[model samples]
Every structure is written in structure tokens, then in C-alpha cells.
Target: MLALAALLPLAGASFAQQKIEQQMSYEQFKAAGLDRLSPEQLANLNDWLDGKLKVETAKAAETAKQSGGDEDRRGLFLATSREPVDGTITGNFTGFGKGRSFTLDNGQVWQQIDDVSLTGVKDANPKVKITPSVIGSAWYLSIEGFNARAKVQRVK
Candidate 1:
């Protein structure tokens, strides 16, 4: 049900794109006092409606994309963290440092954005969690065994 709700607006957006003139019969258009509108006025109205539809479509796409069950595709945008994500490092897990990039098994790559580091620790395919900060949009990446975590930003 929740998935359907997320997709409903996207479906409506494509179907609701009919031009204003095409949405009504001639008599209905004239009855609405729209017949008196100049050609430019009607054009302006249609353009405005199109612009609004575009905005709504973009919003709907974002909402649908954010609906869970798609963890593999997330953290590809910069400076935005909607929720926590868990995945393992693709290969060897070395300690983290500023400017270091970690590629998850799901193919999402996160780059360290802070000066924090966890060195002298080595593990292969260590499980990790990337969590969003409470006060802001910042995110932190934590390895399974290490106590240190680094502030991270999605780069891919």
C-alpha cells in the first residue's frame, strides 16, 4: 500500500499533462469565460500549468525514489542523507582517513569528509553502517569493529 501511494502521483503526472484547451470542449471553454482571453493569455495559462506540472513531477519522482527497498541506489547524491544504510566493503577494509573513499558491496561510494581516521586496523569485507547525524544532514560511516567513525559525503 505504501509503495502504491508513492507511485500514484507519478502515474497521475503523465496523465494530467493534457493542455488546457484539449481538456474541455469548445462550448465548455467559452462558458467558463475563457473564450474572451487573448491568444497570449491562453498561451501564458498553458505555460504556467506546464511549469507547475513539471515541478510536481520532479517532487513525485523524489518521493518515489526515497521510498525504502532501494538501498543499493542510495547515497549517490551529495549532502543529502534520508536514512541509515548498511553494506559491506567490497574488498579489503583498511582504516579510514580524510579524503578516503570506501566502495560498498552495493556499489555506493562514500568519501570521508572529516579529518577523523581509524588506522592500524585491517579486515576484509568488514560490515559497515552509514548513519545520518541527528542535528543536521551530516552522515558518519562506522566499521563493524572500530570505535572511530568518519564524517562522510556521498560522491557517487
Candidate 2:
């Protein structure tokens, strides 16, 4: 019985050693195609994945900014393609108010102003007006023979 017990321990040890020897190295594992990833390849993949994630994150942030808050208001003004009649043109505001008005080419002249509701962007309520000063510091939307001015405000 004592001899048998000693041989049992030796047999276990040999079995364990054999099992360890059968294990493959990293390189051999790759060669077998079971684990075909090199360290450099893994690093490059990680870097590329990180870059893609960053770009997606940035794009998401930009989209969120454009869709949220009062400052996200954008304006589009369509001008008449025809020649101005007596320095006056007509157009519509496509962003906020579906307003139509006549603009004068000369400063210090005011025509008619209207208000409208807009959706899909920031600043739901937009106020629209037509001014004669074409060189104002405000953002201007002009097309061919028409001009539009859009001002965006955030609702607190």
C-alpha cells in the first residue's frame, strides 16, 4: 500500500507535467490559427477602434449641440430670382417664420415685418424682420435678388 501511494503521487506529477508541455506558446497558438493575433496587430486594432470611437463621439456631440438649446437656430431665406423692382425685392424665410416681405436696398427704410413658428432646430419661436442696411453685422441670408436676416434666441 505504501509503495502504491508513492507511485500515485509520481504519476500525478508526471500527468501534470505532460499537460503543461502540451500547451502551446503564443506564437505556436497563432500558427495553429486558433489564436491568430499578434501583439502588434492587437495594438493597431485597438488604436483604430479608439480613433473610430472618438470620431463617432465627436459627431454625436455636434449633432446634439445642433439639436439642443436656443442657440441652435438656423435660418434659410429665399430671394426672388427676378430683377429688383424699384430697389425692392420679395422673399420668404424658410427657417423660423414662413414670412414674406419686401426689402429695400437703401438703409433707414423699413417695410413690413411678420412673426412665425419653426421646428426641427433650436429656438422654436423666431422673430423675423427686413432691414435696408445690407452690410449689417448680423447673419444674413441672401439669394440672387432677395435678402433675409435671422436672429436666434434661447428660451430660458
lDDT of 2 by residue, 11-50 (tens): 0010112211134466654554534456676456445534
Residue-pair clashes per candidate: 1, 0
Error (Å) of candidate 1 at residue 82 is: 1.5
lDDT of 1 by residue, 1-156 (tens): 132132123211333455667766788677667778899988887676666667765664566556642444444532222457899999888798889999998788999989997788779999999976432246789999788899998887
TM-score of candidate 1 against the unseen true structure: 0.52
- Deviation (Å) of 150 in candidate 2: 47
TM-scores of the models, in the order given: 0.52, 0.23
- State the C-alpha lDDT per candidate: 0.68, 0.31
Top candidate on TM-score is: 1
- Name the regions of candidate 1 deviating beyond 4 angstroms: 1-73, 76-81
